[model samples]
Target chain A: MFNRAILIGLAVLLACVVAPAQFRRGGGNAPKEGADAPDFNLKVLKTKKKKIKLSSYEGKKPVALIFGSYT
Target chain B: MQFLLVYIREAHPSDERRGRGRGRGRGPEVKQPKTFEERTEVASECVENLKLSMPAVIDNMKNTAGTAYAGFPDRLFLVDKKGKIAYAGARGPRGFSPEKLEDSIKAVLKNKGVAPRKSTKNKKSQGRGN
Candidate 1:
């Protein structure tokens, strides 16, 4: 009875508390802080076609990569 | 600090349109770009509409950059000089936080280890000058 209550309380605490923090710290299916950014040589949108390499910015300026769409 | 808008495949693609006009309607009736040129057109519209001054880039047909960064709908990330992701914002349209990202940007700038650039051109980006 009391043991079951304690078990239920612990389960609720884990779900309500610990899980979110874990999810935040742990990277899932994506890159997170401190991870090596995957290198890419994408096409720059311009009048003349050009390439934008992610690794090219290495050891230089901190690149702010904004990824999205026009939808 | 440098900025690049990596335009990925459409999220709510115009084909998936619902509703009526601009306010009443969902959005423009633009189809998923079939070619790099088509994608560039849409991306240009986005940049112009937002009045974004930053340079923009387009993801490949296979969305290599998007998939690698888990950037689909939209997201912001700051990579340090070492090419390590310093700040990886959560999935966007929800995790998008100009405030949080700003703080991270300031933090990166404050760290003197990553020095700023001069009037130098990116060696590898010859034809890709911005």
Candidate 2:
């Protein structure tokens, strides 16, 4: 085994290497290509309790789903 | 091609009411919503500020859609007419690339029709290596 100083150095290097993963939290468990899109019926913005269903778009046209927040 | 926006959880909430702390968000500072109504309000404001013309839908209080797709903060996807995921974009904050997304969209649209066309010209003349 390496001496104490060398071991500490190795640990620090490893931590630095993997530190970016901690920042990029999500995106794992995301659906892959050719997989069935998850069906969701969410409330439409400014609508009178109306909802938009993802399944409704199927077989009609290609829908580009953009997921995001304001800030 | 049709575009739809699904407003999910707050990415960088200054108050850190729920999700991770991003110090100060790029746009106006917004706190994590404690209820569905608040989330809707913020999402509306966001669409307005960004001038997102496409229709939008708000995630529920539990963030079900966000958790289901693992699209916290932001993400992009293309669902083909068959309801299958045609393309899944990289994660957000840094991986959220619009250029790449546009390319994918173009590709999806190009393959929309299966019209078998006649091959007028042969590529044997310009074949480099195969």
**Per-residue C-alpha lDDT of model 2 across residues A27-52, encoded as one tens digit per residue:** 45677666798989999998675998
**What iRMS does model 2 reach?**
4.6
Total clashes, candidate 2? 0
- Tell me model 1's lDDT, rounded to 2 decimals: 0.74
Model 2: docking quality category: acceptable
Largest DockQ belongs to which candidate? 2
Candidate 2 chain A: 10-residue stretch with minimal lDDT: A18-27
> How close is every model to the real structure, measured as TM-score?
0.72, 0.76
Clashing pairs in 1: B20-B25, B21-B25
For candidate 1, chain B by itself scores a TM value of: 0.76
Candidate 1 chain B weakest ten by summed lDDT: B121-130
**For residues A12-47, what per-residue lDDT tens digits would candidate 1 score against the true structure?**
999988777644532344575667989999878763
DockQ of 2: 0.43
